[model samples]
Target: MFIQSQPADPAIHDKALRIANETLFIIRCLMREEEWGDYLREAYIIARRILEEKP
Candidate 1:
């Protein structure tokens, strides 16, 4: 992960970390409702699709 400073291209490290944290939060919320498996499956699918679309 990269963090950009002035005079450098914007880095996506912070954004990536935020997304990871959000995913963990979602998993925790889902687990409380006994929905962790479903949430994980959906998250995996969405992540794969996103990766496939990345340049």
Candidate 2:
């Protein structure tokens, strides 16, 4: 017997995609490590919290 996975809900997928894109943008900005030290640290913490809380 074989099992099949259910497709993701469109709304949830869109929300996850948006969050991922925003996180990627944050990471890109964070690559400028010198100028973004404290800001990057805060953003990282916030991102972590958001990801941890995600369903």
Candidate 3:
């Protein structure tokens, strides 16, 4: 989702994709256990941070 909003810079785009993918992967793991409330929220916060940090 966030990946689609990335800029044209290959480096920043790649970094955003990687961060989003890793965050989603962790969320998926939590979802498997049906225990992702706080974790998912944290993941979104981190995603926003990733977006802010990108150039």
- Most lDDT-accurate candidate: 3
Ten contiguous residues minimizing lDDT sum, candidate 3: 1-10
Candidate 2 residue runs with Cα over 4 Å from true position: 1-5, 30-55
Model 3 misplaced stretches (Cα beyond 4 Å): 1-6, 30-55
Query: Residue-wise lDDT of candidate 3 within 1-55, one digit each (tens)?
Result: 3443544456655665566667777557547545555555465556555665646
CA error at residue 6 for candidate 2, angstroms: 3.4
Candidates ranked, most accurate by lDDT first: 3, 2, 1
Off by over 4 Å in 1: 1-22, 25-27, 30-33
Can you give the TM-score per candidate against the true fold? 0.44, 0.42, 0.42
Clashing pairs in 2: none
lDDT of each: 0.49, 0.51, 0.57
**Local accuracy of candidate 2 as per-residue lDDT tens digits, 1-55:** 1112433456644554566556657677546656455554455445444544546
Encode model 1's per-residue lDDT on 1-55: one tens digit a residue.
2222322222333444445557968558536656755665565445444533436
